[model samples]
Target: MTGERYPTTAEVVTGARELTLRYPDLCHLGVVGRSRAGRPLLMLTVGNGSRNVLVVAGPHANEAAVGGATVLRLAALIAATRQRGEDDGSAWHFLLCIDPDGAVLNEPWLHGPYTLRSHYEHFFRPCAAEQPEWLPHSGEAEAAALPETRALVGVLDWLRPVLQCSLHGIDVGGSFVQLTSEVPGVPERISKSAAELDIPLERGSSDAFQWPSPGPGVYVMPPPDDEVAVGDGAHSTWAHARRYGVTAIVEVPMWACDRAADTSPHPDPEQALRIAGAALRRDLPLVAEVLRAIAPQLGGGDCALLRTVRELVALGPRLTADWDPAVRALDAAPLPPMTNARVTSIEVYAQRVPLRAAAMLRRIADVPLVARLVDEWCAAYERAYSPRWIPVADQVEQQARSVIAVYEEMHV
Candidate 1:
């Protein structure tokens, strides 16, 4: 497995090709699509089973370790299925690094001492509009889907697998899972693998506050939000996949939060949401101001770096629209005891957004203003939370275990 050192996108594709040579009968490697930056998107098919299970990773660039985990999972699934009875029709496909362009931008931290500082410092995430999960719209006025998206669309259309599991991850937090439809007992079984590795379930992680959860770690997946420019269900990956198979999303963090397991009811849920929202809302304008002052000097840099900086700075008011609504909705929904996790999420939310803004400025880190902001942001995070680097092996193992748990439970 990748262990502590994560694999680059090229290494992942190369590994899959090597595996194909090792197991010619069961493994097939082929290019499915191309990225805007002209990287070939490769998919590795393993097992001879009639029914297929499509697995994808690296839809987001920052989740470097998850991309590494995908390769591990590909190897593990092949070995597991190879040992199973011939009657077991459980084919699997691995889509290696959908965002290869973005992956290149993150290679700086892929082989790491695994500090949050180094991570954000070198991190790069294309805005949502650029992510492959969104399908291209028909109208010329509507943004086109990335080529990676079209390749996936073709794969999904052809395979129409019984299950499509997208592997995702975070830099710091606990394990969180999302499924298009709930499979009985998967949550119970899924939690053990990560927990044993000291990764708690993040009951209060801030990403999908709007979705319903079956338990602390698993959220019932929802369709893409058009408001965010992600197309509606009819045009989104989840919707397209759901037509043929159920979708499972497994998210494991490279860093763990001890407080994530605590489910005690928060004393002030609205307050927590408000504070987190306020900080995020405050960052956009502040970032814009800085860029505005430095605009004359700001020329071309890392396209990934420049894109994120521009998006965050120009992010409209809608950036935090959900935060206040989330605060208001709290009374109606009654916050689910993220007490510890939720409170910690407040700090996480507050710090993470600004860190992202500062992270994009790493291209210009030589600039005194950018360097100071980066240092300040990094220092604040360090002071508030100790850097606890989760091993790549553990993270990959948890992901494998979680996927296997769901696959086994669903297969039955």
Candidate 2:
């Protein structure tokens, strides 16, 4: 078991290979697919129960290691307990480190100070559309189906497991879960695990857009958006929910404090949507202004950092240019029944936007203008965020336990 430590793609691969080799009678390793950068994606199966449970980790580069660690621990746990029929006749599949190229890019800070600053300094997450989990936008022109995603789709088709849990981690906010439906007792198991780990539950507005929650910290999974979803059922979980029994997404947070769990009354969903949309619209021009002022001097750049800056400069407008229209459509949609959970959308965005922007700018710190921008932007973002981080060990352990708890309920 990997415990609380995050590992690099190579480390995860090596560990999986070792486990399968050490427990030949209990588990076997298989190559899932090659990543975009040609790294072999591996899946390890441990158990021989009647039912199949598929657990995926590290689909997103930045969030991969924590989930990778969790699933590995879960595999060992399942192996230990299921010898006594503890898993209710269920075999487990673990997909380790899906996007190796992107994950390797962020491996520098895995064992260290574990501070927000250090993480951002070493972090890199692809835009949502480009992410392996949501790629091949069945119908979009922006991103084609990635090799990693295609492999995952094939696994889903071949196994059609009864439960699919995609392990994910958040940069900010508290812990939350996304389920295809309200699985009986699963929410309670998740809430209990969060409490045991001392991680606060995110009872406020979620970033799942307009998706409604059946209970505190448990949201009903929504369809893939126009930009990210390819067909009617493009997302792996969404596409297979009907054929399979259920899918649960466990989102572990990188940082959380009591404020993250606040359930105070706030604006309605519609109003919160508009508020967030307005911020996006407002921030675009400012981001563009910063890009414009620095563009000419950036032309001589000959590094990945410059290329990312160039992409962001071009991709920023393309990504956010339609906020105004999107908000209008959001306003037109029917509102869900009200609840006391706070509308933390703007709060989350206030932190997310600047923090992420600062991270991007930090990558090109050798450039004088970019370095200056990074300092100013990061300071402003910190002031606005005023975040208190949950201990790293607590966060990682909570996620591992959360998965175990959910899996237990599924077999019951």
Leading candidate by TM-score: 1
CA lDDT, every prediction?
0.73, 0.66
**Candidate 2 lowest-lDDT run of ten:** 224-233
lDDT of 2: 0.66
- TM-score versus the correct structure, for each prediction: 0.89, 0.83
Q: Residues 1-412, candidate 2: write the lDDT tens digits.
A: 3345677777777787777777777788889888877788889999877688888888777898888777767777777776555656778899887777778778898885677677777767775544666744346653367787778877887888888888888876778877765666766877887888777787754445355666667776555454231222245544554477667778888766456576655446556555555665455455556656766777856554444545554554344322223434443444333333344534565446544654665675445654564566556555655656666567767877766666666654
Reference-based lDDT, residue 351, model 1:
73
State the lDDT at 59 in candidate 2: 70
* Clashing pairs counted in every model: 0, 4
The lDDT leader among the candidates is 1
lDDT of 1: 0.73
Give the distance in Å from residue 244's predicted Cα in candidate 2 to where it truly belongs.
Answer: 2.2
Pairs of colliding residues, candidate 1: none
